[model samples]
Target: MVRLKWRYRKRLRKKYGRLIWKVKNRKGRKGFFKSTVHRYPRRNYRILVANEYIAAHLAKSLGLPVARVIQAHVRGPRGRIKRGLISMQAKGGQVIPWKKAKKKLLKKPHKYVKQAKKLARLVAFDAWILNPDRSDRNLILHKKKSGKKYKWYGIDHGISLFGNPTKWNLRRAKKKFSCKKAYKFCLHSGDKKKQRIPRGLKRFTRDNRKQLGKMVKKIQAMPKGKLKKAIRRVPKGLLTKAEKKFIQKVLLCRHKHLKKALKRVSKHFA
Candidate 1:
């Protein structure tokens, strides 16, 4: 657990939680702050903060691009919330709305063939984690320099394990988790009216399904030790022994069919 002492500026409050004022690093660099607090009965995620922390690490380990995340301390309305989590806002990138990108993207969705290949792994990653929040809105289009190609980033996993973080429990995590809802139209064709591939994954079939297969095999072959090490990144006391074990089971079960599950969906893009 890392401690970030925030130097207050202004607060951006939302329904979920508030973003801390900008923080100044040792070099006095300023950056944005996001905090996740524990909600009661209707919602609880003291453990969920840890979940996001672990998820981010796992995503990075698998070579997936994600925002920088760390566990930190921030003053909440109640008091100093130790369970708070922080993500360093990506600088100098514009969020390309799906509508605009769709024109260029779908027309030659695989134009940047390398990125298209990465998108396959990303889609498979979301499926494995069962995150349904991979909408176009979360994709960040970043251009490093003038006339350079854009770099894409997949953000937000606060709701990965369960639509509502608090909904995760021992029984649910240990059971046979289903991707039906998360992968709905993308992986399994259900309703033409309701089903569609995520904008970020529209070009998922590039490389003749190589990246998808590679990611699936990578996830399925994750050793128990590595999985545990990643999950343990959560702050102490945030997750119980039972909760950790539950999440482990969920990942293993999900990975078991991840390859075939994604292969079925890749055909749509084909």
Candidate 2:
């Protein structure tokens, strides 16, 4: 909820013809600026913007709860315009950070069973996208007005595909695809001696194995053409022809091995 500087806001308004109200200030990362008129905030780099755009479409195809993102033009350094993305903010609920949401789930497991399942799906989604930055602050938890139910959504895929925005060569993509390591959830507490299974994952026990397997199947069943269409949605110049082809190849390859990768991590639930 950090407000943009007056000077910066004036510059953006002059170039983009929109008023920016706030920008999220994530340490070590460029902030996402929220627009007042359109509610579609601008992100930092074109590469990161393209990554968010492609990731959102792919997540939706797999039935994940991610915000809709669209390509946008924003004022860059020295009054230059650059390609960016604007993610629609979720409505009708108060957004809670993952750390607070985890505490609530752990304290009241029965009340939040549904959220646990969503977390399971999110973990699987992160693995497929090769996102290693699903930290405690990345997942957003929306508590409804009634406060009885909660909706979970994943965000910030700026470094997901190829694991590096600047480097999308086949060698990097291939190395990431061949990796067999399971994606770990950032649910562990600070005390190492008291570390145990997090409540977000505890509800997904043996009975839910079939449900998890089904999610894997759904991802595998995703048509290659659908993925192509999603990638093609990214505005031209944002992603190079070589980068697009590399991403398509990497995703298809990962889909083939998704089941095994998920199974390797899901054993903990059993």
Candidate 3:
């Protein structure tokens, strides 16, 4: 009876724990979930896992810049819905009020863009090259009362391990890379066309890289247990192609490039 009860509790936790949304008091709110999805043979993943992974990643890096992932949740068609995990409520750093800024104040959002790009370079150098899914939806903009603003985030990461992995390439990666970390690498790298930046698409990619780097730096500095606990909650969902080796190769390639970047930027950061 004891053994069966333990097993039952575990199952219940897994079922409810995996869900992305929650409510405190009467305020309906969202929560972040970490997840991945397998291909057809394995069956698709519910949204719960995917969203949480993103929230954790973003929340991990608000120290630098990139909006914060306040809450992420996962629920299927059958689950109740509020707004969303990474939707409007997310917060980490503060963003200047763009819509409220005036002509002279035009600098806030544009400046926000520049800092966000700086954050993205960290992602590029670190080889976290899953670009498309690293969009504004998963990230938040933070502006402080001090008037000094920077990106502080990276909320979603589930989309990267999947097929094709967001139209990424070495050249764009190089541009996003830190000039301090990979100066020479940039020199040798071929000039690849910028990922086609539509009105909103380009900005999102640009900001994600900046935040990605910020997150990595923070994670590298954190205690092992904290990081492990944070990631442990990440569910083992299936990646898009389900070809783990391919994803591994991509990550490995990115690591090698990161080494080159570190060497290039040694003078600056060192």
Q: CA lDDT of each candidate?
A: 0.59, 0.56, 0.35
Model 2 lDDT per residue over 146-244, tens place:
777677777667656644344334454444443243222211111112112334553543445665677778888899999898888787776778778
Best by TM-score: 1
After superposing candidate 1 on the true structure, give the runs of residues whose Cα lies further than 4 Å from its correct spot.
1-43, 73-83, 92-102, 109-116, 172-197, 206-208, 263-270
Instruction: Give per-model TM-scores.
Output: 0.71, 0.67, 0.39
- Report lDDT (Cα) of residue 108, candidate 3: 32
Question: Whole-model lDDT, candidate 1?
Answer: 0.59
Ranking by TM-score: 1, 2, 3
Query: 99-215 in candidate 1: lDDT tens per residue?
Result: 357456654556742365676678778777656567665555555455345566666666665334544455644343454433332222111222135654554455446777888
RMSD of each: 5.6, 9.5, 11.7
Off by over 4 Å in 2: 1-44, 71-83, 107-110, 113-116, 166-199, 202-207, 267-270
Winner on TM-score between 1 and 3 is 1
